[model samples]
Target: MIKSVWQGKKTFKAQSKFGHDIISDAPTESGGDDNGASPVELMLSGLAGCTGIDVTNIMKERLNDTTKFEITVDDEREDNTSRSVKYVNLIFDIEGEVDLKKLKRAIKLSVDKYCTVAHSLKATIEPKLIYNGNEEEL
Candidate 1:
């Protein structure tokens, strides 16, 4: 479970079930103290984190290289009041001697089969790959 307490000036102190605290705040323009990441940012961060973990575990089990890797999540939002998200992009930047096929399979499994956070979202997710600085497919 998660609990969020309103800190003054459009900020919230949210605690996860595991007792980790995350400070959510609005930007200065949004009448907040600019103390931490906004809720939307945190949500995106959660997606990245969930997928990252899944891929890491899968790679480890498959005996793929785990030297260097990073996941970047990006979303496109509407301009209206709701600011509804249109789609999300999960970019995987990987370096070192990793097997491309295995890496792609691991990412596909995470995005389509194992990631709870990805399954929970309502937007389309496009997964991209960059291997050793070169863009690759799926």
Candidate 2:
């Protein structure tokens, strides 16, 4: 379970049952102190972290260096009052000697089959690849 308490002036402190704390606040322009990540940013970060863990584990054997693996997530949100997320692009950057096919498969497995956060979202998630420096569509 998760519990959140208002921390005054558009800030909130949320604590999970696992004892992890997440500080969320609005932007200064929105009358907040602009400290910590916003709720939407946290959601996007969760998506990235979830897939990152899955992909790293799935490609453990293929990964030459664990430190070189990274995932960047960019999302677009609706402009309406709700400001719901419309779509998200997951960009994977893996450097070193790893089979592209295997890496792609791992990402697919994470986003399409494994990551619970990915499955929970209503937005469309598109995965992209960046091997070394070249960008490739996935």
lDDT of 1 by residue, 1-138 (tens): 897899898999999999999999999998999999988899899999999999889888554545667888999999999897778999998887878898899899999999888888865768678799999987
TM-score of 2: 0.84
RMSD after Cα superposition, model 2: 13.7
What is candidate 1's CA lDDT for residue 84?
Answer: 76
Question: Model 2 off-target regions past 4 Å?
Answer: 123-138
lDDT of 2 by residue, 27-118 (tens): 99989999889999999999999999898899887786445777899999899998988999999987887888988999999999999899
Clashing pairs in 2: none
Which window of 10 residues has the lowest lDDT sum in candidate 2?
61-70
Per-candidate TM-score against the hidden true structure: 0.83, 0.84
lDDT to native, each model: 0.87, 0.90
- TM-score, cand. 1: 0.83
Clashes of each: 0, 0
